[model samples]
Each structure stands twice: as C-alpha cells, then as structure tokens.
Target: MRVRVDDASAGQRIDNFLVRVCKGVPKSHVYRILRSGEVRVNSRRVDQTYRLQLDDEVRIPPIRLAEKAAEPVVPFGKPFDIVFEDEALLVLDKPAGLAVHGGSGVSFGVIEQLRRQRPEAKFLELVHRLDRETSGLLIVAKKRSALTVLHDMMREGKVRKRYLTLVAGRWLNPMQHVKLALHKYLTEGGERRVSVNSEGKPAHSIVRLLKRWQSYSLVEVELKTGRTHQIRVHLSHLGFPLCGDDKYGDFSLNKQLEKQGFKRMFLHAAKLAFHHPLTDQLIELEAPLPPELERHVVQVEQTEEKEYG
Candidate 1:
C-alpha cells in the first residue's frame, strides 16, 4: 500500500503515521515491519522516529490484522457533549470511563467514535488527552493548523486548564502551590505509572480550596506543566488522595466508596480558556460536573459537617 503524506499528516513520526494508516494492526507488528525495512518513505528506509515531511510518499507492506471474537466495530459512543465548535476545532465534554484515543486494551475510544460518527470529516484528531477515568472538557482539532497551534499554546503556557477534584481530609490551605518533579515508568507487568522523583520533569500545580466537608474537600487545580497524572500525583503526594482514584488513592477508601455506590475518580476538567488558534478570539468553556460525581459530593456532605464553600 502506498500513502502520500499531506498537510494534515506532515510532521508526524513515521511509526505513528503507519499506525493511523494501518488501523486495526497491532503496534508491535507495525514496528516489526519498520525495523525489517518492509516500510519505506520516499523510496528510502526511514527509522520509526523519522518525521514525515509534506508530499512524502510512504510504502507499506500488505498486512492482515488477526481476527478476534466478533464485536462491534465502534464501541457505540454517544455524541460527546459539545462545548464549542468551529471550522478549526471541536471541543467536547468527555465523560468518565472513555479514553481519548484507542490503544492498549481499549478497542476504540472517543477519536474513533467521532470519526465513525462523522464519516464526512476529512481531518479530525484529539488535541490533548484526558485520563480514561477523568471527565470533562476535551479539545479536538478539526484542522491540522488548529492542532499545531493548540499544542504550541499548551506547551508555552498560553492556555489555561483547570480541574475539580474531591480529596479526603480538611485541606487547610486556601491556596497552595505544588512543584514536584515527576517521572513516568512502566510497572513490572508493563502498565504505565508516574511518581515523584528527583531526576524527573518538573511539574507545577496551583490548588485552591473550593468547598470542604469534615471528611473531604473540593479543590480546583490548575496545572502549569502538563504531565501524566500530575494532578493526581501531586495531591496524593500531599497526603490528600482524590476520592475514588484507584491508581493513587487510598485503596481501602476507594473500596468503601465503591460499596457506597460512588465509584470512579473524582477528578474533572471543569474549565478551559485559550485564544483561537486561527481567529485569535478568546474561547472559554466550562463543563458541568457529571451527575454521579455531583451526587458523590452531596453524599460526602451528608455524611459530614460542611466546613466551607
């Protein structure tokens, strides 16, 4: 198979490009072909890290995806809660338990569902990722230019993203700054994990108390540097774990919460603000808390004395 790189695909790593072009194929198999010189760019063997330039022609060997048990092509996701939209962007209020894109154990995610739903869309891609357990504002780029600019804006701190989370205990400080260096590592079983380490990327989060109960506190966390599980790690390191955070929370508490019918993490991307990548107009969007999480807050309050709001 021959694929021509266009503006939408330009600047992408060859490995990633191949993954998209060869959907349903295993990533390991894709790398196997690349390393064995079965794939070439512009008639020359290129390493997996090679970034594709505009007009580059790629040659791919024929591939057959191993069949599995009969299942639906797309996981049948409802149209996401639309936050804002234009020719250049599609902002969505993503719900918990839905991954941003497909890979690793997930058959298909929001990106695949969006593509399936809008078959006429020529270009659509996720601009940023939210954890599968996280809910709320997620940005999707409708145009490559918008994706590039949004990424640049996020890296340069030109964009603002805030999250709401409920953590245990009375977080005394009204406002606190957490600057922790975080390192990503894979577990022995190869699952992804993050932790605070001296030799790691610096992460910053400004947390403000929003509401409090005797047993829990709701805080708004603003990240200065985006990192995998930054908010969860930071709060966890501070001795306040996000309620129902299975990865870094009090596991006993999580089990108890689950028994109480409040399952899933209590983290949300509640607010986002940024300048238009193309029009230069400021865009601000807010996603209301999911009803389950709201009810969890109410449950906590009912079980304890309200301290502040």
Candidate 2:
C-alpha cells in the first residue's frame, strides 16, 4: 500500500501515523515490516519512531494474510438513520433499542444493515461505539485509512461525545463533575455492568444539569473514558439513577415509567465531535431526541409540575 502524509497529520510520529493509516494490519507485523525495511518513507527505511513530516510518501508491501477477508458475517435489515456520509466515513443517528453490532444472541444491528445497504463498500469499520440502549451519532469509516485515523483519535481521547439523560433525582447543582472509578464484569447472562471499585479503571464524567423537576432532572454528561456502563453505574451509585434505567434504578420507579409509556431507556447520545480522519478538519454532529423520548420528557415535566404545584 502506498500513502502520503497530508497537511493535517504533519507532525505525528511515523509509526503512530502508520498505525493510523494501516489499520487491520496487525501491529506486530507492521513493526516487523518497518524494522526489516519492507516499509519505507521517501524510499528510505526508517524506524517506527521516526517523526513524520508533511508530504512524506510511504510505501508498504502487500501483506500476506493467513486468511482471506471474511464475508459479511452480520445479517441485514433496512431501518438505518444516517446523519452524515462521505467516501471516507459515515455518521449515523442510531435509535434506542438497537445494537451497534450483533452480540449476545442479537442477529443483526446498525452496522449489519449498513453493510447490506452498501455491500460493495470496502473496509467499513466502526470508529467508535454506542450501547444498545444509547442512541445518537455513531461514526463508521468506509476505508482502512479513515478507520485507522479515527481509531487513533479515539485512543488519544480526541473524540468528544455528549449524552442527554433524565435522572431520577432533583439535581440542584446545574454544573457538577462526577468522578468515579469503574470496574467492569460480565453477569451470568453475559451482559456487561460496572461498579465503583478502588482498583478499577479511572473514569471521569462532567455532568451539567439542563433542567429540573420534582422527581427527575435532565442532564448532559461528558464521559472521559469509554468504560461500559460508566455513566449509568456511576450516577446510580451517586444516589441519583436515571429515570428509565431499569438496570440501575428503583424497581418501583421503573415500573411507574413503564406504565407511563417509557418503553425504553431514557439515555440518548445527543452529540458527537471529532476530527475528520482524512482532512483533519473538525466535525460536529447532533441527533435530536426521538418522539418517544421527547414525549416521556414532557410527561415527566408535567407530572413534576403538578406535584410541586
């Protein structure tokens, strides 16, 4: 494969840049190629740590794969909401109750449907992920180059995501940060959950209260680490669970919400901000609350007003 460093990635390390550009190629093999001169920059062999300058031409030999690229293993459907799309990437507004990828007995998800929509697409990859119950902007890469770049950006904590949720308690503090350590473990049902632990991975979230009511509060959360259930578990542990969070909320309240037509969780991925993998330009994306969630919010507000009045 041949690649040229563009202006956006002018000052990155050569190996780092290469890793971003040559995704799905194993890291060990990538380094081996770099060490053995199979990979070259400007036609000269360089170490993995070599700093990359703008306009550097890199040449890499074809990799011998132990197995051919697999066929589409995921099943397909037709209900996909795309927010943005280009040759290099696609941004989707995934709805609540839909998984991003198939797992734990799920036959298909958003990615599967997307694959079916564009079967000829090569190197389609998920840049970041959202939980099955969380809905909003999801980034999908159409090429290996874009995938590698976006994944690197995610690892470096450059991707910014914001979620809007209705929590169970009244939050008087409009601006507050929720810092907690999260430990992940699988349940007997093979579902993932998190808990506060001293030896767990460090997780931080900045939560801002957007609105308040007698029984629930609408808040915006910014998660620093991509830990599973970090927001739900942390906020639950903090004594204010989400309004419709069945897994981490009062059972009676959840039952009440169910009666109120809240059929799904109230969490929503409201926005996404990241850098364009190919152009290095900043990208900001948004997804509005769906009808169900919107109605639930209005109902909760009305109920709260009645109780307080």
Question: Which candidate has the highest TM-score of all?
Answer: 1
Estimate, for each residue in 1-309, the C-alpha lDDT of model 1 and write its tens digit: 898888788878999888888877889999999999999889999899999999999999999877777765995568778989999998999989988888898889999999998988978988889999999999999888789999999899988999999998889899999999999999999989999998999999999999977778999999889999999999999899999898899999999999999889999999999999999999999999999998988888877854444
Which regions in candidate 2 have their CA more than 4 angstroms from the true location? 1-76, 188-190
Q: Which stretches of candidate 1 lie over 4 Å from their true place?
A: 1-72, 306-309
Global lDDT scores for all candidate models: 0.91, 0.82
Residues 182-224 of candidate 2: C-alpha lDDT, one tens digit per residue:
8988899887777899799888898999998777889999977
Each candidate structure's TM-score, on Cα atoms with residue i matched to residue i, is 0.82, 0.76
- TM-score result, candidate 2: 0.76
Candidate 1 global Cα RMSD: 4.0
Clash pairs detected, candidate 1: none
